[model samples]
Target chain A: MNALALGLRRARFETAVYFRQGDTVFFTFLFPVVMLTIFSVAFSSAGNFGTKPDGSGGITAAAFYLPGMIAAGILLSGVQNLAVDIAVERGDGTLKRLAGTPLPVLSYFVGKFLQVLATSALQIVLLLLVARIAFQVALPADASKWLTFVWVYLLGITTSAVLGIALSRVPRTGKSATAVIVPMVLVLQFISGVYLSFSQLPSWLQSFASVFPLKWLAQGMRSVFLPSTFETLEPGGSWDAAGTAAVLGVWLVVGVVAARLTFRWIRKDS
Target chain B: MSETEHVSVRDLRKTYGAFDAVDGISFDIGRGETFALLGPNGAGKSTTIEILEGYRDRTSGDVTVLGQDPGRAGRDWRGRIGMVLQSSGESGNVGVRELIAHFATFYPNPRDVDETIAAVGLTEKAGTRIRALSGGQRRRVDVALGVIGRPELLFLDEPTTGFDPEARHEFWSLIRLLKREGTTILLTTHYLDEAAQLGDRAGVVVGGRLVALGPVDEIGGQDSRIPVVRWVDAAGQREQRTTEPTALVAELHRSTGGEVRSLEVIRPSLEDVYLDLVAKHDSTATPTGVLA
Candidate 1:
């Protein structure tokens, strides 16, 4: 059989396994929903801190935080999930065994890439459903708004998946993978508007957050899920769709190249 | 380059800096023959096997597996080879059947997944998640995955390391069954008994060199070593290592008037020969610093 067919088969098998695992499902699917629910409910009745400017007459914190929460879901599934899994597999000899097989290395990764996409897709959908039901946030219904979501999510998953895979090579061993990744994810979450608005963070912090794809992802997602009047809450006081695309696009290319350059079939042991 | 030789290496050397891990070894594995590379821990047996498996490169040598230089061999070459690693199966949650069947897709022609599972004696646990299975059962899954591709050459690296005695026996038979079906196997094992039982020919490596290579039992010409005859003497003591024990026994028989008490003949076992060779080699060679 051809490698593409086998890769898809492998992808199906792997995705099924990922879905069956309680921890994987919890992290990739349920955790995002839970966090979104808590954030939506906690900020629902709370007074506005930034004199928020969404044109819905009153500040709907859920609507404001909806896009960032989805971005968080995307980050967990695409970046943290893939990075941790690859690191653990590296230490356990799975990658080495797979390398020794007749399977093409690219096919094996393509299989994993599919799993990341599946999990991230499920995460985004679930978070959206929670926001719509509990917070009364509207879905992006029009074709053009849906189109924005398409490019943003596609670029988001592609960049983060490759970035996750590239970063998997950094940890010395599987046991330390969490130690290496957790801090980065948390810092990005704080700065990239996952929990607060980009404009709410200090000015110096805002500049730092703009360098990463997470900030652009959250910003791009807000463009899809929020009203155009909400752009004043952003850093530049406008919805910079091209800026989002440019930063994420550059990261997408850099991540692919970085993954190719840094990936190792065998674990690096001192 | 002979028609019957499936794998061959000449003057193979692997060096990490000034330290030689595999030093100038040459050997041949005949088609469909089970060849065992036997050595104690860190004897460079794994290094040699990895070079043949195309997972490692030799610093300087000519090597070939299935008539292709393994260092430059491509995917088509890989389809013809199979390997079971020392440790694996730290995999995602999946049943035995699923993982084995999935691996079969890599090869152009693969054996029936069910048959492979049955051969490895995992028919009962086919649907059980691998992490829930016992360590030995997980190993059987590894073997099933390895051989499902119907590889022309199978590499088993310390395959039975942690298996219980019964499980080891079953695994041995599974390998025996594969060999009977004309699979050329090259395995590395520290267990001398495993090599003796499964290998038509065994090579003993020590300190990065092939010290002995021949039929399993006759390694180091143990069979040709003299046997010692022991019997009660006027001194009531014993001495061995007699070159002419049979005639010596006759001479002593005449002296003792055929009343040979506590009479026995002692011959060196393969283990004795192996230990002797290793001890001698260790004493002579400078210790290479640990690489692993």
Candidate 2:
């Protein structure tokens, strides 16, 4: 089979396994939505960021949390999921078996990339639906805003997935994959404006988080969902679309290079 | 090497720093022949097999599989070879048939998934998750996946380690079926009877070297195959190793001029010769390499 067909086949295989595991389903896909629901309920009466034109209510906690959750969802399904999954594959000898087969290395990555895309798409949709119907959060109102969302989403996930593949080598064994990966992902979520407002974080922390992609991803996502007036709340008092693009773009290249250097079908010491 | 040889290894050596895992071992396996590599736990069998499978890089050596250097072989080369690792924790969440069918697509031509499952006696558990199966059943799944690609050459690395006696018999029959289909197989096993039953030829590895290589019946040479004549008579207990055990026994009976006490002829089995070979090698203080 050609590379495309083989890659799609592998994607289907990975998706099947991903959905079957209850832990992955809950932690990677459903966790963000669940967190969104809890935050919306907990801060329902806190206040509003801005008021809708209809003046019924302003941007509720769900609206503010929506884009952040979407960004976090991208990271969870992309970097965290792939890192843990690939580490498990290596530990369990799946990579060794595939290495022995006619399967191309490019096709294997294609499978992982596509699986992340599919799962991330589902996660984003679920988060959007919950925010829209359950919590009355508004989506992007124009095609231009959506176009921005599209590029950001693609670049963010591609970078995250590559970094995850690169990070798979860090854990010595599959059983310790989550212990090694979750803490790093969680720390990024906190400082990257996923769990808090970027403008509210200390400038030092913002600068530290700026070096990573999650902060920029969340910022780019806010540009899509939030009204233009809300850009003033950003760290730079604007969305800085060029900055987000540049940072994520550089990380994408870096991630691909790192993955190439670190990825192994089997462990080195073995 | 001849054109019929599927695998050729010349002076293959794999070293980890100061220790040599496989030290200057050389052997060749012909097409459609079942060659067993018999050894103790740390006897460099897995290292040699991994080198042939292209799973590990050798420190220095010449090794080829399917007419290509496995170290530099491409996907096309990998497609012709199927590997069942010593212990594979694969297919934990996937169904037996599903994983088999998925792997089948990786080859140019693959066997029918259901047929391959049946060959491994996993038809009943085809829909069951691989992790849900018993140890032996899971091993059958490993075999199923290995053969699903219709490989020309198969590597069975201690394939039946966790099998029950009945499952081992079933596995042996499956191997026989594959051999009948003209698949060249390189098998590594600690089970001497398994090697004797399935192997056309066997190589006895000891101390990171190919100590003996020949047909199963002929391995360990004439000295190893010598029969023992034992008799408890006037000398109390006496045992002698000789090629002519029948003549020795007749002489004992005639010299006694009566019925001999505890007189018996003991022939050495493959296991006996293998044990003797390993023991002999161990006693020589050859500085055996430590296996991983």
Candidate 3:
């Protein structure tokens, strides 16, 4: 079989295993949804974000936080989950077994990419449904907004997955994989505006976050889910679509290069 | 190279800094032959196997597996060989059948998934998660995956390390079945009996060198396998190493002119000969730092 065909077969197997595990489902797929719920409920009585500059309407805390949750979901599904998963696989001999096989290294990564894409899609759908039903958050109705969401999501997920593959070698052993990766991801979540408004963060913090992909992902998601009137609240006083695309595009290139350099089917010292 | 040679290695050496993990080893495995590599811990068995499997590169050697240098072999070369590692059930979250089926796609010609599972005696556990299975069952899953590719050559690295007696016997039968189908096997095992039962020929490695290589029963030579005639009489304990133990015992009985007390014949088994070989090698060689 060709690499693509073999990869898709592996992807099917990975997707099944990914969804069946209780820890993976709770941590990767549902963590963002649960956190979003808690944040929306905790701040529900605080009222909406003032009024729209264009006199359009009011946006509740839940509505404002939906895009952040979606962005965070993408990060968790791609980066945090994969970094830990690949490290565990490497330490447990999964990569060694595959290395002994005829499967191409590119095919193995293809399997991972497709698995992340499938799980992330499902996770985002679940998050969206929960936000819509429980918090009554409005869904984006414009086709253009959905198109923006798709592109940003594709770029953000590609960057996260590749970076995750590269970062898998950071942990020396499987037991410490979550310990090493979780803290890094959590720090990125806080600094990238997943848990706080980007404009409300200090200018220095915003500048620091701007160097990473999560910040651009969250900003792009905001542009998709939030109204145009909310654009004035951004640090640049507008939704910089081109800026988000450029930053994400650069990170994607960086991630691909890093993954190519660092990814190994077997440990070198072994 | 012989037309029947499945694997050929000459002067194979793997060096880590100044230490030679595998120092000047040479061997050939014929097609459809089961060759067992026996060694104590850190005796370079794993290093040699890894070099042959292409998982590790040798610092110096001429090596070939299935007519190609394993260090430079491509995916097509990989497809012709299979390996069952020391550990088992890596994809624990996946079902047995599913994982086996997934691996089957990597080979140009793969065995039927269910048939392979059955061959390993895992038919009943096909739907079970590998992690949920017992250690022996998980090992069977490992064997299932190894044979699913229908490999021309299979590497079994301590394949029965944790098996119970019954499971080991069953695994031996499974290996015999694969052998019957003409799979050239390279097996490394600590169990002397396992090697004796399955190997057509055996090689003993010590301190990164091949100390003995021959047919399994003849590894230590005629001197080592000689039967010992032991008896008790007026001369307090007596023993003699002899090829004709029956005649020696009769002569002793006639000389004593009565029933000999505590009379018995001892035939040296492979384990005894192996321990003797290792001890002799250990005493003669100068001490070196741990190589593992």
Candidate 4:
């Protein structure tokens, strides 16, 4: 068979295998739903949670945390999935076997890219469904807002997935993969406005967050679901679609190059 | 380019850091021959094989497989060679038949998947997931995968290492069957008996060099050194090492004026010559500072 056909076949087989694993399916699809449920319930009553800015009124916690939940889904699909899967495949010598075949290195990455895209699409649909049905959140009414969400989410996921593949090359063993991913996940979540609004953070922290794709992604995502007036709270009183796209595009290029240069198909021990 | 030489290597060298894994070795395997590379662990057999397989780049060497330099050969060249690596960690979710069918697509011409499976004695387990197969049965699957392309040259690296005695015999028979089909086979094994049984000619590798290469029986070719004669003597038993076994036996018969009891002549086995050759190679190379 041609390389592209073989690559797609292998990639489909890999995706099927991932779905069969009970724990993977739970973590990839079910975990987000569970977290969204708990967060929605805890934040149901407007005045019961954290107070609003200026202490004049209490912001509805559900409104404040919905964006974080969506960002978390992106992280799960992009970073966590790619990192752990590549590391495990390397540990098991599957990559080594593929390296010897006629299948080129780019084909493997293409397969992974397609898998991540499909999974991310599924994650976004599920999150939107849960928000509308369970929490009574309003759906995007305008075509432009929905288009913004789709592009931002796709660019965000593609950047993170490629970064994860690049980063996974550093860990030689599967056990070390978890150790590397956990700390990175925690740090990125903190800086990305997943736990708090970037506008509420200190100026220095805001500037630092601006350097990463995560903060821009979360901001871009929030711009879609939140009111157009919320744009006033942004660094500029506008949605910097071009800026967000640039940051993600740069990261994508860097990630693809680094993965090509550093990735090792065979085990160091072997 | 000799007509007899099906495989050839000249000044093959591979280095990792400051160490020479394969330090300038050369050898040849004749057409329709089963050649065995015999060595201990860390003796550079694997390095040499990896270079030959084009899985690893060599530091410097002139090497050819099927008359093409593996390093620069295209897909068609690779299709002509089949390698059963020391370990293959392919996914186990697919049934054996499905897996073999998938690999068969890589070649321009492939053997019938079912017939190949049957040749490896895995017909009963064709539908079984590879993960569920026992170690021996899994090894048979590996063999089946390696030969699926009906390659002109097959490289079997420690192919029967984990096999039971019965399974090993079956594997040997399969290899012999391949030889009958005019496929040149190159194998590396730690098992001496396997080499003795399968190799038409065996080469002993030591300290990154080939110490001896010839037909299994004539490796050392020290036939005149002495044969050990053992038999029942006047008291109980006697043994003697002598260069002239026929004269000794004749003298013993004349002295006894009758048939010799329990007469037996023992010659050196391939294992004995192999160990001795490796030891001599080791001692000679050490003083000059050779490294494996």
Highest TM-score: which candidate?
Answer: 3
Q: DockQ of each model against the real complex?
A: 0.59, 0.64, 0.66, 0.32
Query: TM-score of chain B, per candidate?
Result: 0.87, 0.92, 0.92, 0.87
In CAPRI terms, where does candidate 3 land?
A: medium
Candidate 2, after superposition: displacement of residue A257 in Å? 0.8
Instruction: Evaluate candidate 2 and give its CAPRI docking class based on DockQ.
Output: medium
Give the poorly placed runs of model 4, Cα more than 4 Å off. A46-67, A264-270, B1-6, B91-95, B222-227, B231-264, B284-292
lDDT of 4 by residue, A44-120 (tens): 76463344476643335555566666777777777777887788677765676565555556667777877777777
Worst 10 residues of 4 chain B by lDDT: B283-292
Chain A TM-score for each candidate, in the given order?
Answer: 0.92, 0.95, 0.95, 0.87
- Worst window of 10 by summed lDDT in candidate 3 chain B: B283-292
Q: TM-scores, in order shown?
A: 0.92, 0.95, 0.95, 0.86
Name the lDDT value of residue A102 in candidate 4: 51
Candidates sorted on TM-score, descending: 3, 2, 1, 4
lDDT of 3 by residue, B190-275 (tens): 99899999999999999899999999999988888888777787769888888899899889889889899999898877777888
Docking class for candidate 1: medium
TM-score of 4: 0.86
Q: Report each candidate's C-alpha RMSD, comma-separated, in the order given.
A: 3.8, 3.4, 3.2, 4.7
Interface RMSD of 4: 3.6
| Alpha carbon lDDT of each predicted model | 0.82, 0.88, 0.87, 0.77
